[model samples]
Target: MMYKKLFLLSGLVLSLILVGCEFTKKTVNNVNLFTIEDDINLGLQVSQEIANDPKQFPILKEKGNEDVYRYIRKITNKILNSGKVVNRNNFKWQVKIIDDIETLNAFATPGGYIYVYTGLIKYLDSEDQLAGVMGHEIAHADQRHSTKQMTKSGALDLLLSAAIGEKEAVKQVVGGIVGLRFSRTHETEADEYSVRYLCGTDYNAAGAAGFFKKIGGAGSPPEFLSTHPNPDNRVQEIEARAKGMGCRGNSTNKTEYNRIKGLL
Candidate 1:
């Protein structure tokens, strides 16, 4: 009886490993064990958790902040309409504003749930710059970087537990995403995709480069830079790519952007 039980357990482990391998094989750029559906579910779950935790998230309510939400939606919609995002129609793509002026950062969850800090919105100079940041964050979701990072960090066991309907494991996975740090390679891909996404729009293709230039020239890194480390020649690379693509749109719409800024 003991020998038979050992054999069964070994078979189960092997099966799980094979399942993980299969999922990993299906990913686009890296070894991601989660499927697109998994990303949607996980992002939805994490976003709900964030919504409930007002002390931590402080999401600005759309009740009296209709204009702000509308402005954000306009920017987000332009990028989404650019036709470059994967799973664009399937993912939620909900945008939320976290009302914290001190934290200058923006992030997207696995399935296109984006949260931007007020500090980041206030800090940017023009509409195109904000659009650039939004595009980069959207790329992170479209590319499923969070799950890829989770796979790399040995969260396979946790994922397996979640697969087996372990509720606590799911919660842990969702909770662990509070401050997930993406790799430099993922960051670069996001940056490149930002330009690519913007290239399809009227916004400046190298708008993201402007943000990097400002922060790098400022000499003091904000929370955004801390998570997204500005490597050498990042600006040059972005500008060069935009120029190489021959993207003609250079409209920053600074006057209108300043008007929106005044509303906040």
Candidate 2:
């Protein structure tokens, strides 16, 4: 009986090792093992929750809104067309501006839902600067950072469930604590991806560097700082990335910039 139990225990241990290796492999490929369909579903659910929350800024709607959307779409298309974004074909991209002037923040959800606050737009002096911010947020989606976070958290929950003899409840907890940790890592990697993508686009890569400069002295830290890298550290990283890519200094579009600035 003892020998039989040892053999069964060894088999279970080997099985877990194989399962762990598979999970790690999926995560390392820069791709989430979960399907885009599932990601979009989760994103839609979370987005609805955010929309329902009182704290989220209201979505903006105005006359000539399509024009603004079209212009931003053009810019997004340019970057997406440049082959810099990963899994470009897998998403339906949407950008929304919240009409909140007090909050300076932007973020991208899985399945390509991006939100930018008007306060952040006001801070950007040019279209390229705007692109720098948008690109960074979009990079988070392209990297599937959120989905990967969900996957990791899910795996951990499964392990915990099995340990507690509640394997059936694993899926219920998959999108828990582990997901939060992955989300943080995804934010940092997306920052790097943004720098790289900006280098190849018409957007002034140095605008990214200058962006940090503008935000650095802003009296109070904004909501963006909670999940984003420190502006000072981001500026240094942007400078170094731009230097490696041969992008130097600000290259503003005077005409487009003035037009956008006039609106603010």
Candidate 3:
């Protein structure tokens, strides 16, 4: 009888080990399953919902602002065509300017839809500064960080359900999980990608450091810092990375920059 009980315990332990291994494998595989196409589709769906919702910010379309749109398109296209992004072929990129002057922010939807607020543009001193901001937003899309966040949220919900032994509790778990902010690691990773993208392109990568410093000292957190690392820390990281790449201060894109600046 003792031997029989011992055998049963051994089998149970093996079963638990197998289950744990499978769960780990699933989580790792799901992380890799995120792709640019998936991100774009998710972004599009979210954007459409936001567009339909009256509470969301209105899409900007001032009569004389066509020039502003054209200027943004020209610069964005130049950066996109630079071939620095590893997954650039996967996106059908689009840029839109928000008319709101008080909101200094920019965000990228999963599908390559990027929105930049007029306030952000007004604060930018040069084209490279604008590119630096846009590049960081693009990096978030390229990395599919949102998808990973969503996946992790779902996984946590499942784990919570199992721990409580009640499927009905999953909704509460999910609600809390969704509200959980991303860790510092994700912000750092995005910053790294942004700098790398800028480095291989015509955009002055070193200018990114200055932009962060300006934003930090501008009496408000940087737009990029809204869902990212602290601006001060980000500036330091950018400065270190830029120095390593041999990029230095006050690089010029003055001609094209002035044209865009005039529109603002």
Candidate 3: tens digits of C-alpha lDDT, residues 3-117: 3442343222322221122123334424633455556555555555445543455677757788888888876776676667766888767888877777767777655777788
Query: Rank order by TM-score, top first?
Result: 1, 3, 2
Residue lDDT tens for model 1, 140-172: 898887778666555656655554446666556
Top candidate by lDDT:
1
Best-performing candidate as measured by TM-score: 1
CA deviation > 4 Å runs, candidate 3: 1-35, 155-181, 217-223, 226-228, 247-251, 254-259
Each candidate structure's TM-score, on Cα atoms with residue i matched to residue i, is 0.82, 0.69, 0.71
Question: Which stretch of 10 consecutive residues in model 1 shows the poorest summed lDDT?
Answer: 15-24
Clashes of 2: 1
The backbone clash count of each candidate, in order, is: 0, 1, 4
| Model 3 RMSD vs true structure | 10.2
Question: lDDT of candidate 1?
Answer: 0.76
Residue 161 of model 1 has an lDDT of 59
What's the true lDDT of residue 106 in model 1? 86
